[model samples]
Target: MSGIYIHIPFCKQACHYCDFHFSTSTKKKSQLVEMLCEELELRKDEIGRNIQTIYFGGGTPSLLNSEELDHIFKTIFEYFKVSETAEITLEANPDDLTEEVIKMLNASPINRLSIGVQSFFGKDLKLMNRAHNSEEALRSLQLAKHYFDNISIDLIYGIPGQSNEQWKRNLQQALELDIPHISSYALTVEPKTALEKFIEKGKVKPVEDEQYREQFDILVETLTSKGFEHYEFSNYGKPGYHSQNNMAYWLGKPYLGIGPSAHSFDGRSRKWNISNNSLYINSIQAGKLPQQTEELSTTDSYNEYVMTRLRTKFGVNLEEIQEKFGEKYKLHFLKEADRFLQDGLMDTSEETFHITPNGKFLSDGIAADLFYIDK
Candidate 1:
């Protein structure tokens, strides 16, 4: 099934670690939203299937008022063949999830909420420059659970000063709320971000490797014991609650990405829109698409399949690879995977090969090693 992803690239405030394309100013918010609706209409015929999921991601989708959201939804319904039970998700911040907002969202088409509750401690929140405090984080989830059953919360580990105890408290708090799904990640300092600058100037300690690994281990063990499926490397969900949009992506289904800086993937190629909001709006007004596209090579396709599938619980399907790509690719994969299997970094079922827990943290590197280099 196909999906649609709308990038709402406007945030209330910029977080210290965020490097995603977003504007802190709402000066062009109205125009951007209008352009987004236009983009959806422009690309309506791209995906020739019923859209099963609609994900509202980035900058902070929670910042959009009800009227803006309704207009966008109306446009989507008018232009796209959306499934009746589509999984419509909004990525929101805690501070924006006021009771009033939750009430409005409950009545809207959005069936899922991915709350960005980075940490539950004031010190961590301040360090990350999150807009919400520890109190707002809890209160938002408490109110959200009351309205939406399909909810996911984001948590971060490996903050420089976040101790094992603090990380445990964070997990315990999420579990106490009975959150069905969670997406957690290590706090990597990307270049040009405020966190990276802080580290370079010695204003903050860099993330320690040992602490990061320890907390990751704690995260895996703690969540798995509580019956959460470690489906993707950084995502865990209960049965019947896994993210449909993300799963469609991992499985390499086609999707249309609308709005500035959004990326789209058909079966054979990938494309991304221009990152500048003004440029995007201007181009749309000029009746032209502002995006770049790339056609995938066979080797490119093979490597991508390996990279995305290995991080998943289903792992790499050897038979499917052989059937779809060729025997040579599958043989090459088995040959290269020998060392990882021998070292217990990976394991193979009768039909699939997957990273073991010992290798999950290093999955990206491992996937790179197994990449299909055109020789």
Candidate 2:
């Protein structure tokens, strides 16, 4: 089964650390939605399989009123073969989730709500320049959980001044809420973000890797002790509550991404839509898809397999690697992995090649080293 993702690239405000493609000024909000609908119709035949999930992700899907959401869902139903019981998810901000909006969303085709409750501390919220306060964040979650059982919350850890105690408190608060799914991520200063510039200007302290390590350990231990499955590296879910749409990607299932800065994959080649909102709208208005496609070469495919699988809890399967990429590549990887395996960074069962707990911190570096370069 395939999935569909629609990026609503508009937000009420900008988060300091965020570098995602979005516009704070939503002057073209109406036109943007219309173009997304058009893009849906234009690429309907790209996926030949039945849609198992439809995710409303973006700058802020909760920014959309009921009417806008309805129009988009209606268009999706009309154009695509959506499963009768497809997992429809809408990513939302806590500030926008009023009781009225929650009630409206309950009646809509949307089945899940992934709220961005980054922190429950006002001071921490201000540090991140988040739009929601602690009170609103808690209220929004409570209101949505009343109607929707399948709820997920996003939490951020490792802000500049955030301490280990504060990080643990945040995790405890989330656990107390009994959220079915929790996505926790460490703060990284991505290049060109406001956070990065602030660090360069000495307005804010840079992220400390030591602090990140402390927070990450706290996160893993606390969540696992509470019986949450560390399903993906950054994602945790209660029994049987894992995100189906995201799981599809981790499992290498095909999906179609629509709207500005969105990416799509058909299990081989991948395509990305233009990040410029006006350009995206203009191109679709001109009866064209604003996207660039890349055909995945054998080496590209092999490297992707290593990267994605290594980050997962299931780890990399050597047999599948050998089967799909050939025995030569598999043996080469096995030989290359010898050093890491002996150094306790890699673990190998007869069936899988996984990273040990100590190896997770250096996962990216290890994956890069394991990458297949053109010879």
Candidate 3:
């Protein structure tokens, strides 16, 4: 397996725009941790090779205590063959990254930290209902820098009222922190999210696509100009600092996901644990894994390949398409993509299809148009 992803499904508070599975009450935190360990042990036989990465994504993994973390680590070490130099990362929030927490993490097996500092501005933080204020976000990074070298921070752009100047300032602040990697994304209003209700109720202004595009352009220009590679659509990393766990997903490497709401993928199938924490914990305690599996069809794999590869620097290779999906699939891709190549939206010079600068903003639409769906 390329990596293992463990989801910590407890958050201090819900962000207005978030739709991910999580709970505000960490009442069952200890129980959940035990179940996660049990699930890990139960699925140990699935991985046939040494794991190269381990990522603790959240709800807010930083909420985990040292003892809790150690227990999980011990279980992992006992059950799996993890590489000595594995890129172990823990997703954190600024409020939880006190000096004590930072020092504790620094002494642990984890070598990387992905901090969720959605905004360095109080106005933006408040609007998004983020638990950390502007000062806390800045202070935590300063403290984290003293303990960690491989660090990434999450930033959200295109907040309804944020100006281009403010957006640029956010990038500049992160750059000043000497952050090696950044995962910046536009603030999207998902259905049933508070952000969506706010917009619909006129409590908040709707984010314009034009504004989002402008900020994205600003992000790409600013980060790349500072010697960071736009490795994936939303991820920018300095050389040798790209996220291994993230790359595993983008490159379609096999990974095992453990915990409520976590998703996993082998070469041919996908599985996702139940989203309900209580159901997940109960099922695991009863010696049953609460997950649903989907066996991917040829069209499913082809669509997935097109969707993910098109978003990264490693664009699709025609020969690779044919070898993996058959000649008809490759032909379909070319026939569907012929217009883009002719329009200069996609480059075909190297027998590899890459999105040109002019087409980056329309990447999702382009990828969708190329997907092979059965009639």
RMSD of each: 0.8, 1.1, 0.8
Worst 10 residues of 1 by lDDT: 41-50
The digit string of per-residue lDDT tens for model 2 on 222-266 reads 998999988777899999788999888877889999999999999
lDDT of 1 at 42: 85
Per-prediction tally of clashes: 0, 0, 0
lDDT of 1: 0.94
Which residues of candidate 2, in runs, are more than 4 Å off? Answer: none
Q: Please, what are the lDDT tens digits per residue for candidate 1 over residues 1-375?
A: 799999999987889999999999999998899999988888888977588999999899999999999999999999878898899999999999999999999999999999999899999999999999999999999999999999999999999888999999999999999999999999988989999999999999987789989999999999999999999999999998999999999999999999999999999999999999899999999989999999999889999999999999979998889877898899999999999999999998887999999999999999999998997
Model 1: how far is 348 from its true place, Å? 1.0
- TM-scores of the models, in the given order? 0.99, 0.98, 0.99
Q: List the residue pairs that clash in candidate 2.
A: none
| Alpha carbon lDDT at 56, candidate 1 | 96
Writing each residue's lDDT as its tens digit, candidate 3 over 1-375 gives 578999999999999999999999999999999999999999987755579999999899999999999999999999888998899999999999999999999989999999999999999999999999999999999999999999999999999899999999999999999999999999998999999999999999998889999999999999999999998999999999999999999888999999999999988999999999999999999999999999999999999999999999999889989988999989999999999988988997678999988889899999999999899
